[model samples]
Target: MSQGSSPTRETSRTDNDGNDADDDNDSALGSDQYSTASITSSTYHYRQLGGRSYPNFRDVDHWEPVDEKQQESFDIRHHIYLMQNNQKLFNAPVQPRCVLDVGTGTGIWALDVADTFPWAEVIGIDLAPIQPPWVPPNCRFEVDDANMNWTFGDGRFNLVHIRDLVGSIRDDEKLYAHAFCSLEPGGWIEHTESFMIIFSDNNSIPEDCVYHDWNRLFDEAGEKTGKSFHLAERIESSMKTAGFRVLGSRKKKVPIGTWPKDPTLNEVGLWNQHRWMEGLDGYGRWLLKYVWSLSDVDIELFFTRTRKALRDKRIHAYELYTTVWAQKPGPGGQ
Candidate 1:
């Protein structure tokens, strides 16, 4: 549990003669270019395209957009999660000794958890290098593709947390199975996601509104991409099939705008609106152009209408957010 005893790794570099170079002397080569540079350790090589940076993975990640807008939206969503959970990091009752954050965008949750539980060692894995270099000593971030094989040893984690990975994962069952196997006996795994489809309680949203059109486009695009936004709704059964015992689940109706009657929900709605507004262009840019095959001018006009609709309090549309947690059975299959 000491700092020195934490996860140790080494970067690999080859000399001009194609021989392995010593880790200590690798930096001594002044002018000679390394024939091969392999990262035996966790490393990130981000690719920039179309004014955005993307992760370098064998299979392209569903979420290819990355910029300041996405980061702001992520931070806003994190705050909203804290607000909904009353500032609790997670719903699991146990005080985990080790934690793994899957798809840790911005590493906000991992950093916060490290601060909350200073005794715990927190590891965050993501495709992008958006996390800051200055972080809590107990917390670390790795650029990894979660869809591939997990490198960590089995049963090494006490808690595994996933958030807002709706359109990123292609196979929920495989991811849950990995989580189930990676967790120690009695360890907990929690997945949080917001269903992308908007809803209304009292027929406040109209069929003619752009909100409906937005939902339809997203649904169609998700279907074509094989990363459905509706995948979060089916995670409970997937987790159960992966051998996790259901602990608890909760669903909250997050308003799309500041149109809620209750004061708390109104605040939540305002935050949610900010998140949507910041992400409006990024969300619609690629999907509309590539998936929906819309022209740039048309896409802009569509989002302009979408923005107006989101601000309309009369629409009264809300998104569904769900958090589900389950525990790996201990000895005797309890």
Candidate 2:
């Protein structure tokens, strides 16, 4: 979504027609389904960098910050998606009895799904132990790394959900393979992601826009980690390789500021702006400090200008969001 003189509202491509909002679920396998590790004081020992909190996980190099401000950004992003999808949790046709949310940052989606389906067992897992201790009776959270071999015993989950974890995943196919193995026959795995690059269809952006170079730096950082920020475009192929038959996929243009003519899109752009303003720094901090070799002053200046550019509604800038859901083969191998 973008800010500037109103160009035509961008249209998204979808293989199957649908309008539904969904959140991700996660679980780390143990003898009892949820991982045996507990969220203790050791897990809470987060490193405070630039006034943002980050996990101390040695296994994976997660770039995003895990502070209260960042969590609020995540919640706002959730509401933006809900508005985009007409408030539906999922488009897949099924009454899920069990759901697994991988990379379930903040655990908001899992809690909502648990409340929506009281009888269902909802589990969420992530590298950080930021999820609240008290949750729905049917919902639980685990602190675990998703890239490691998933031990969630095979054929346990009816639905596996993931969202907004593009640059964090080092191997997309391997992650999908783990999700494929954990799902039951006929179960569904849904993933939602957004392109990191900014786009404007009507030349709304100035020639000196900061976005042109900002996204490239992210790509370079992702390359160092062996993860691709453009994984949204590759979701289906990876899922297909993991033996999943495509169920449906949809795309939407998420606006950056209130630039659109439609009321709903205008609101979406407002939330998107809030998201960028509040969280983009968190999104790029680690990468900038460790990978990009930028000094503190340069990082601050870059972010300041990016924020300024994002607020310019005359730029008409937006990012593309893609949601893909697929099913594993059922009884008799379908």
Candidate 3:
């Protein structure tokens, strides 16, 4: 069934603060399918950076919070997925009985999947309590760090889904191994990520453009922070090393602006632009401050220029969106 057609357990809901408000209850996921150790009570505190709030998980996680800008970007990203893949979730071959969503921002994808497969339990784990309280009965959200040892039992999940965790995960190999061991025999693991590198087929982007400089700085910052943005390019090899049978992978060129001639691509570009515009500060603020030691004013000036560059349709630059899925060996396989 399409994500839009999935039934929501609640018609209206409140914000993350548990306030009574009229909001879409269709935006959350998780139902506590697996058991994890009780998280420390000191997890709810947030750190402020560049006028945005981020989870302070005692140095365990360095991800920004699901603030207004991030929420808008998440919605735009959801739209981009529909325009590109035409589905809320991937087309993995497995029929999941239980699903795990790692780094489940806002719990939107997990919620949609729970509604789509009401029989399967869906759990979303993030560093912050950003998910709405009202959600599908089969879906629930938890605050935890994915880098630590997974507390779930072996073979507990039929499908493990991770998306856009490149800049947040320090050791992807370990994460993949954990995912491989957590899945049932013949279960699937799907990873969807985008690269920081931008490309142009027609050489529209100039050498001296701020976009190129921004990417270079971003890459260097990620390397210094030990969270490389290029991790998506190595997912296939990592999964293979974890004993997963390589299913297949696909890549799509996502434009930075509404410059594509094709209708679908143009729509994709529009959402992508909106995502970047809304997320430029949240994406770079912490990195620039902590890694590069740049002042807040300097970072703001840099992003102001970067946003202008992103709006330049003459550049025709695009980022690569890659989806890779693999399955664990069953009894028949070695």
Residue 256's lDDT within candidate 3 is: 84
Tens-place lDDT digits, model 2, residues 183-282: 8899998999998888888989788898887778778877887777878988999999999998899999998899999999999999999899988889
List ranges where model 2 is wrong by over 4 Å: 1-41, 332-334
Candidate number with greatest TM-score? 2
Error of 3 at 230 (Å): 1.2
Per-residue lDDT of 173 in model 3: 84
Total clashing residue pairs per candidate? 0, 24, 4
Worst 10 residues of 1 by lDDT: 1-10
State which candidate has the highest lDDT: 2
Per-model TM-score on C-alpha atoms: 0.85, 0.87, 0.86
Ranking by lDDT: 2, 1, 3
Q: Which regions of candidate 3 fall more than 4 Å away from where they truly are? A: 1-41, 61-63, 332-334
- Prediction 1 TM-score vs. true: 0.85
